[model samples]
Target: MTSTARAAHPFITSHGLKAALADGEEIAVLDVRETGVYTHRHILFAASAPLWRLELLIDRLVPRRGTRIVLVDADETLAHQAAAKLVRLGWNQVSVLAGGTDAWAAEGFEIFSGTNVPSKAFGEIIEHRKHTPWIDADELQERVARGDKLVVVDSRTPEEFAQFSLPFAHSLPGAELVYRIQEIAPDPETLVVVNCAGRTRSIVGAQTLIDAGIPNRVVSLKDGTMAWLLAGRALAHGRHAALPEPGPATLATARDRAEVVARRAGVRLIDADELARFEAEAGERSLYRFDVRTEQEYVAGHLEGWRWVPGGQLVQATDEYVATRRSRIVLADWDGVRALTTAAWLAQLGGHEVFVHAPPALAPRVTGAEPVRVLPSRAAAPLVSPLQADALLNAGQAVAFDVDRRAAYERHHVAGARFAVPDRLQSFTAELPPTQTVLLVSPDGVLARIVAAELAARTHRDVRAIAGGTGAWAAAGLPTASGAEGVLTGDDDHWYSPYAHADHAARDAGFRAYLAWELGLVAQLEREGEVGIRLIPAA
Candidate 1:
């Protein structure tokens, strides 16, 4: 945790806090308490902004540098830490009151108590400036049914829309609204409404759109879908957009599109018999099931095999995802639509034996509609699999690649592995063990297949996908890995026959450590236009 560079005020009792509140000053009363504790009670007028994203809120949303930023926390440690983060961002006028809110309450000052409504009020304040209003479930339902020509802007993130939506709604997350607005809802005449599990994104998104001077009418679907369900209004959880796979360019230099493609590609398309047999049997070949969706959505619900990897990030860091690197792939989501798109992209990259998971839900995400046209998969598309991958795995033959997200690769992988995602399959061409057999692995067969196809496109060579994901191997009673979470790379490994561990720490410690490190855990999905350097493995 960093320190606030500005002059910090001495600890003030509750009296001072109350005095400050009554001063009519534009002091931001911040709640630095844990999320659970803060939600139960906080000082009146104080905002409950978690420290994990103090920088996220200050740097991105709160624009004015001189805005008097105050840090308040149930604990002093958090407030001080937050203060430093703000100061580092060059906010000169920042300060944290010593003793924090607990000290204030101890001094007999009034503390605000309630759920996280202040932030909502804050969003409302921003929206009200643009004359934005709130719409109840009935009104929304009526309007949508009447074809009110309103643009139902589901301000909840895309997965939220995919999970559940109102009529005529297009998902535009709060953060992406300003940037993705043109792509999702361009017509100014169309009305837009924001929503979320509750009020946060809805309120924020609606306000943001209005503040941008959008000629369209913008409002929050007040109370969101929860309110809709309670109000007896119909809910329309519809089909989500088919996020495409990352292209060759995107997979390597910009893993953005590539990750999305891999995540959304769903499971490696397996033969029905093979899938059934694998379920009936268990062995360890390092298998993993990745449900390619936003992490938040994955937390809500998902298939058993899926490890959450947002497609965009997968394209960027597949090589680090240890599970995908060594395991056979099975990709899934609310339905197969996204998985198919991801699969296609992976096929181009050359990992064959791809399979798309078929969600049993009738209206998977949007309409639970079944696809009308079933195209032959990439396995059958313009490429063929190698009879065996041993030739590539042999030393000095071909590149032995772990083709998945870098994060997944780093956690657990083949004993001796080389990092490379499908799109960046060629980024390490010079480093590869020349035309030996190029053995590829991924939880999503599509990416592996895509890499193989791309390699073949250049050399007409064959490649192999792990028959079952690494997870499947373990389920089949094969060897598996286990360890405590801290210092993961230092943990023990259960060996696999076909693959080997790379001399990462010994030879490439700096590079591996660089990619393995992150500013935060539970990372947010990378929005478009994010440019920066990273330490993830090859491609």
Candidate 2:
């Protein structure tokens, strides 16, 4: 068992965790291990928070620092580190699980295993309870081969769609389905099929259309793209067709449909004054206000303090946004469709007072400061310009490491810069060639400063950050490479959908695991005992 010497931040016993759960108290239990390990197994209802990014993400994950926070790790090392960081950051009620997850398992509590388990499980429950309709992959493939009049709408983001999708599929991410479907399939005779990398979004998207009473026959692609590949079908790559802007008729239809769905789900439409009242009560209760729209739409213009969270992702990853279960959530969108639909789903999911804020106009008013940007916690070291870095590198006195995501590095990076994984810097340090100085570069200066601080502490070599980041470097007309170079760590941060893998065996295994995880969700829901979900039966 872990020692409880640090009384300032006490260590809660496994029994204490169980008692808190049984009592239905307001608490945030976080599993501070890497996603790879956390996905394998973790205490039920515990949110994933890898120690590497905990500081940067803590504010968003648990906005109320004083809320009782219980951190758990499989081992003692990470939980203690995370707890210390929280206390230093002014969290008054931080605690660690005594003996970590081992202690919890000894007490015989159910430990969940999978990524986005709640969302995936909820999807399974939705299908079982709501009986969402779907067309098998073989049927869809045969229809396509026979040149049927059909429209395939991929319910993933444009970026994901661009990576891979079914042939002739147009990009129409979740929440946009109700708003844009009429334009995509103008003819009622068109057989509309919705698909994602997997089942959740596909089912949700298809159900959204069905609930809206669309004349088009909308159905989810069974088991999503994984089933497509499993049926010996080929996938389309690098597709970019996007949902066109809704015409007047389509927009009016969407608005009317949204109102019906909202009314059915008992979602309230509050005006600006009511929203103000909710915000004023923040001291007594937490209020999470969001603009449920695309990032581009959000960045263009949004209400003050209204952060952007695409409706689909918000529903799919509830734990990331609303850690406090019973807190109030207010959603806003330019159109009624996204906000109303998202509010309906949130209300059905339970534990929160959910509402849709209906503004006078659909276009976002240019109000409020930009969203909070996460930066390094500590002061940055001395900075160097990209030109200065180039000179130092040419002389072999310095080495440059691009600290951005691998995809970004592969898109464009400084010609000689190596792709360095920040999480694995300690292990990768030995592989770096001997140099008097090390230069760190990121998409923005923030990550570089964070990494520079760590390198300065660990090595004797001089460490510095690039003044701006890759954007600045590119603007300076520097030569760049368009592929990943000298990648030091595996890209495990992003858990791709099982349908995304090209390997038949790997994809099959992923689908099986996904199905198994989802199949057991109803049992876990019973174990959790507090998840508020009321399925809106199929219309």
Candidate 3:
């Protein structure tokens, strides 16, 4: 348990919470449970903040100290623990939901069950209001077979696009399509098809192009690649077709068109000086500065202190980005198109004060920040080299515990090693072999140390991290084994995405369930009264 004292925080009953919602107060109700548990059932508008990750995520979730926060759990333990942590982190107006989610259910209030519910619901809402046009897989396949002049744009992350997509689909992920479409499809008469692994991105991407008044006849690939697979079509895997850089003429046109759409959506523009002033006051208000650009572009160069969130995914998963309800957001991009277009949609869709920040000259190109290896300032666990670990394993003196995702561990892990989910290690340690020395390994050394520290505290055994983690081990020509040999806990922190499921039956079921959940959100939003989304009709 955290050593922080439980502060004098009020516990609001479900009835009181309902009243607060009805009264239009600025509040964020968070369910402090694992993603799997939260996805099964959680209060509507309650974002997931799993207890294990509460500390790492709380800053992003409740950035504002004064925002009214209500923590909910199946039991009061997680809620109380989370509240104590939040209070220790200097969050004010923190409270716990009395009697937890059960109390909310007992009060006859809604309890939604699903992952990415807000984004999925919003996509459905957009489709219902705008009636986004789409083409079925058979029609698209026939058109392609006939040598039709068209382009298929895949609106998923680069990694996801690489996994699987339509054969002809170019990796023009989400917001990038706004700026890159002109270069990819210069001919207005050409048919442009947008697709994702599933429906949401395709629907939103196609509609965005239409709304921006792109001359092409843009349409969504109905039900996306999942539908294609269901229709007995095979998707291409490991594809790398991507859009080229926009020329001067194409870039100019994109900026012009995007500005018009931004104006229509009432996206606010902030100059550098104004943004500086706004950022200076971050202590008093929650302000998220994001570079709404592709990861490659962001990696090549971006302004300081700005994180990259591809515009489309940011809007699609706003809750994942901004957890503090009603926080201000400032979006930046090299060209005005992507950021402005994203800001416009986010303004209406997120109900947040959104702004577009156009740097004078791309904010002076600099290498992006390195990925942080989260570790305590002072870590006591000794770091062991891969060679040392190998000798220890050969001698049967130490057991290696891989603290990584189950999928990663199954892909390639140290031979004869066991998998351990760091959060549940205490409950899982008993399953490990009887060894005094425990070797903790992660994809990188940073996470291994944290888990190593935790294991050290719990077992009172010699806990050491594999120096440089699996990467170093692999780099040293160490042999690895594939498949889940010894998994301590099920991979439940992330809800399974329908588009990525390998099993056809499971994928189909996920799609059906996702669509059903989405269809119900409009009524829920109306009753729950806090989504704050206003559907702007396409002109």
Output the number of the TM-score-best candidate: 3
Per-residue lDDT of candidate 1, residues 93-185 (tens digit): 666766676786676554543343323333333343334478987888788778776766665546557756765667654434443454445
TM-score of each model, in listed order: 0.35, 0.87, 0.90
For candidate 3, lDDT tens digit of each residue in 1-539?
Answer: 11224445678888887776555546677888777668888876688877655545666666667888889998676787677767766777888888898888888878788876777778877877899999999999999999999999998888888888788888998888889998889899899999987778998899889988899999998888877888888988898765688988888988888898888788888898999888888766678888888777888888877777889898788877777666689998578789988887888786468888888873576676524323242245899999999999889888888876677788888888888666666666666565657888877766677667656865777889999988899998888888867876665655667765668888888877776666688788677666677766778
- Model 1, global lDDT: 0.47
Best by lDDT: 3
Poorly placed runs, candidate 1 (over 4 Å)? 1-11, 15-33, 44-110, 113-118, 127-130, 182-189, 234-239, 242-539
What's the lDDT of the predicted structure labeled candidate 3?
0.79
Instruction: Report each candidate's C-alpha RMSD, comma-separated, in the order given.
Output: 24.0, 3.5, 3.3
**Local distance difference test, each candidate:** 0.47, 0.77, 0.79
Could you tell me which 10 consecutive residues in candidate 1 have the lowest summed lDDT?
490-499
What's the CA error at residue 299 for candidate 2, in Å? 3.0
Number of the candidate with higher lDDT, 1 or 3:
3
Residue 299 lDDT (model 3) = 89
